[model samples]
Target: MSNSEPQRQATVADSQAITVQTEHGLYIDPQALSAHLPALSYRDNELYIEDVSVSGLAKQYDTPCYVYSKQAILDVYQAYSDSFASLEHQICYAVKANSNLAVLGILAQAGAGFDIVSRGELMRVLAAGGQAGRVVYSGVGKTYSDIEFALQQGIGCFNVESISELSLINEVADQLDTPAPISLRVNPDVDAKTHPYISTGLKDNKFGIAHEQALDVYAQAAAMSHIEIVGIDCHIGSQLTEVAPFVAALDKVIELVQALADQGITLKHVDLGGGLGVRYIDESPVSIADFADALLPKLTELGLKVFFEPGRSMVANAGVLLTRVDVLKPTEHKNFAIVDAAMNDLIRPALYQAEMAVIPQQLPNGGMQADDTKTWDIVGAICETGDFLAKDRVLALAEGDILAITGAGAYGFTMSSNYNSRPRASEVMVAQSQQQLIRKRETIEDLYRDEMRWQDQ
Candidate 1:
């Protein structure tokens, strides 16, 4: 933590030199709270998560590991559920964002439904004890196989992105001799004020059906014997912090729904695709109650069953990717603390220009630093030159200190890969002081198991 201190080796020797706390004299800080990330905690200069110790977790699991506090996942799910408990909305967990069967199983155990984008994702939900009757299949290009799979599972409905997709679903369900329930994913053209790549509800984006065509599509689907018009849906975008766009999109969707009813095509559900944002940097997240307060009244007035496909908001901060410093280099221009993690492990900062709160396990002042004097660049151990995590970070970090990148529970490990042949990291979940390995660290043989040497035919 002390920049002036000579760079030390990243080992337990660095950890041993620290003085131990005395039980008689040491009193827990009454004001101690986790980093305010979902249900995470950063107390007493240490992370006690779900009753499990953070540093101890890294010791058992290894560096560049993802440690999820099990309780945080529950708390986040309940946050949305409680927000709309008085209402008749279904919180359908988006499986594509974080489809670890373990994570989905946990949510399913807590009575959560799913919003799947692929047949494989729908199968994952089913394998995790999620009911097909509660899952909603959503994607733009649903293949014949994908449609057949969803029809077989009897998911809640398909969010048809285009008219062609609706026809395809009708054919697939007709061939399979089943009635496919569907919802038109209408594009309201609302700007969700998010990254360009992840935004969905806009007309320009290749996601949902255009707003003008939604009513006609629904009417036609109602006439088809194989396809039943069940609902309407839209996902505005990801990491959205504003309530105005969603409120606007809601109005647009309701208007479309009313237009469909004028033609005698009444829908039973309205899947308001989820893109409610979370606090990642300086921005604050609108409370679930505020979102419900903003949109539920409109939904109730319209008299429709509501559905949500929240992915990021429910899991983003429920976990943290814990990495250890691999080396350090102090140049005249900047200090680079290279950790064992890489962009392949967590790409949000590199891909989205995302900013995560970088907290060193211990600083010179015992995790308290308000100095405007020192700055360091936290980077990863990867081959690519662009493999940096945090730029101009304000922490007075040294070579060996462990760092916890907050708000990584959702799109973090799910986006990681074995780039540069580096072994993918493992993941652990801690609940009530018990830490269990949810995912294993990849081995070289495991990576090459699917690969084979063959003579050219």
Candidate 2:
């Protein structure tokens, strides 16, 4: 059948059971793919994100493109907002998750604030029409220029990580003659029970001030001339699946807040840093509502403004990385499906040892039929041996078949690099079946645009 042809449903039966063929013609996996991917479905034997075909997107935007569903993003953000409806809060979409201008614009329009870790991110938020008063500046190493820039922008608050950072912000604010609204990101030392790399609240991790030292730090901050201690914040880790750690961290934060109040330093808000995990493979992470439900009561009792810095939970499932298989090499030991998208396009698989869902853009009329299936290692074109997307994944794939790398919306493009001098992929956003190219694919000439060859003697 042609790539654009409509899919016709078919059924086959055996003595044991009968299997129904979906639009993409997969029969073996009985579970609906749509259940996992809310915005994804098979239409006419082609993968459709909402209403647009993935193959059509691949053809139009070229492979290795990052596609996002606007509706999906809105839905996730709204879930967070609705969950905290009873409380005074701000859902600051972490800009690092999917910082495409179009993505930021959509969230900004949806009344979502931003939690930024850099001045560039702050600038992106501004460029995307985000309100400066709604942006919170985060990160451990905020340079003088960044501090001065954020202060000038009238940002909502600075999530100060250290005493030294507080001193720096105070110094910068003094220099700028502006009061810097700030919060101390206290390390509650709560176990996030997640990957060590993403864990931040542990005492050893270099993220926030120690929980024990936070009261003294707050007292010190209250005396600073140019500093206004606005809130208390804690982030345990990224991709957190449980609620106990969050509650534990909040319990510590609440205690600290009360201690500070006794010391005549009352915070106006409390920020529970966003580390809620999303479903990547077989893992079942906490739902947004459940996560909020677990923490909102305590926050309400504290009677302070609440802030959530959700990055992955807000965008991870809203997007996929589209790549085309270049060749299928069957080796003596293992099989490899070499694809055009390398670690440069999506690095979570390499960096976090992340397991992502890999689905074919088009499935055959029947299932793989056992004999046709092979356990293939999805390797990328990057030169490093570690440049793999998935290993030992059983799939029936062929050359030129497009694959959707699921759970790629977060930490996908933002972590992308021009390694091996390869240009970065373009980004597209789908809103109501309309495809919008948010970022143009990088060109060879675009690389090193700022570099100049020095004349040698």
Q: Which is the leading candidate under lDDT?
A: 2
Question: What is the TM-score (0 to 1) of candidate 1?
Answer: 0.90
TM-score, every prediction: 0.90, 0.93
Off by over 4 Å in 1: 1-35, 363-373
Displacement of residue 61 (Cα, Å) in model 1 is: 0.4
lDDT of 1 at 160: 85
lDDT of 1 by residue, 219-281 (tens): 788888798888989888998887899999999988988888888888898888898888664
Worst 10 contiguous positions by lDDT, candidate 2: 1-10
- Candidate 1 collision pairs: 34-41, 34-42
TM-score of 2: 0.93
Using TM-score as the measure, the top candidate is 2
Clash number for candidate 1:
2
lDDT, model 1, position 10: 24
Off by over 4 Å in 2: 1-31
